[model samples]
Target chain A: SAVISQKPSRDICQRGTSLTIQCQVDSQVTMMFWYRQQPGQSLTLIATANQGSEATYESGFVIDKFPISRPNLTFSTLTVSNMSPEDSSIYLCSAECSGNTIYFGEGSWLTVV
Target chain B: SQQGEEDPQALSIQEGENATMNCSYKTSINNLQWYRQNSGRGLVHLILIRSNEREKHSGRLRVTLDTSKKSSSLLITASRAADTASYFCAPFSSNTGKLIFGQGTTLQVKP
Candidate 1:
């Protein structure tokens, strides 16, 4: 199991502003992923952050809206650009460790007003 | 679109009883995993059952998979109030390593 930490556990931002969430893992991981959970809904994969490369985004999500950066193997960041009220959701970062099991950060809850 | 769907959106059970949640997926998967999440927190991995395996267990949690039907079930025995949380079943595609999560079953264990 990996000990993962995410900054800005909860934040309230004004519409049109941007919020960047940080994810730090205890050790180097093979892959890192970002997910969004809307209230009362299932999680949606936003993108996969690969170290030293551009993030790979899923369908219905674009790089412009959710830009990601992975400076190293143990750290990654997801920035929600030009945010709106609809963008309010809990953003979670996860990493795949040994045994094909994935561990998640505590999550950053963002509320866009 | 989501690959898996869990049955019984919500469930209320008494402590010491057993709670079971079912999940059905759309495509082939290398493995299926169950996760638990407390309110406003990240998900915690519970157990993983591979496509070749029928069942797996960890502590008090048991998971069974049926690849022919593309479905799975999670059973929590001797439930406790601390077990109250949302349970999700995720299937991983070996080709992508992306886990597709289900809607989740919210279980409330009453003490």
Candidate 2:
């Protein structure tokens, strides 16, 4: 399995400020997924980041609010824009490996006050 | 509604006892996987059961998949206090790596 690392493990930002979380994988992968877990909630798929293309967002997520960028196969970034208190949650990134297994990053915890 | 949903959102058991968590999905999946999350940390992959496989085991964890019913169950034998965590089932196998995680079952194993 591939090892994933996420930057800014935890952060506190003021409302209306945006924060970008970065995810890096040890090896190049074809697809990277971003997920959001609100306090006391399950993980929700935010978007799919594929290198060299626009990200595919889930129904409730918008590119403007949660913009994603995957400049290459091994790295991707998710930015929470125009943040609000409601945006406080844990953001995680995962990469798919051989045998259909997925590995997750430590996750970035964001708090909008 | 999410594709995968887990039953008994929370569970409590005694150490050395067995713990079981069930998950049901709405769509056909190529494979199902179980993951464990400790408190506020990232998820750790526990086991993966392919659609064609009935059961799989890893260490103290056992996972069973029933494609006919679109459901899966995770069993932890000889449960320990360290097993207390949120267990989630993810539907993987689609060409897209994006996975739909179930609501998850919070298991608390009292020592």
Give the per-residue lDDT digits (tens) of candidate 1, residues A1-113: 89999999999999999999999999999799999999988899999999988999998999999999999999999999999999999999999988788889999999999
Which digits, one per residue and each the tens of the lDDT, describe model 2 over residues B10-97?
9999999999999998777888888999999999988889999999989898889998988999999999999999999888757655
- Write down the C-alpha DockQ for each prediction: 0.83, 0.88
Cα lDDT for residue B10, candidate 1: 97
Per-residue CA lDDT of candidate 2, range A1-113, in tens? 78999999999999999999999999988889999999999899899897898999989999999999999989999999999999999999999888778999999999999
Q: Candidate 1's chain A scores what TM-score?
A: 0.98
Q: Show the lowest summed lDDT stretch of 10 residues, model 2 chain B.
A: B92-101
lDDT of 1 by residue, B1-110 (tens): 33779988899999999999999988888888889999989999889888999999899998999999999999999999999999999988778788878789999999
Superposition TM-score, candidate 2 onto the true structure:
0.96
- List candidate 2 segments past 4 Å from native: none
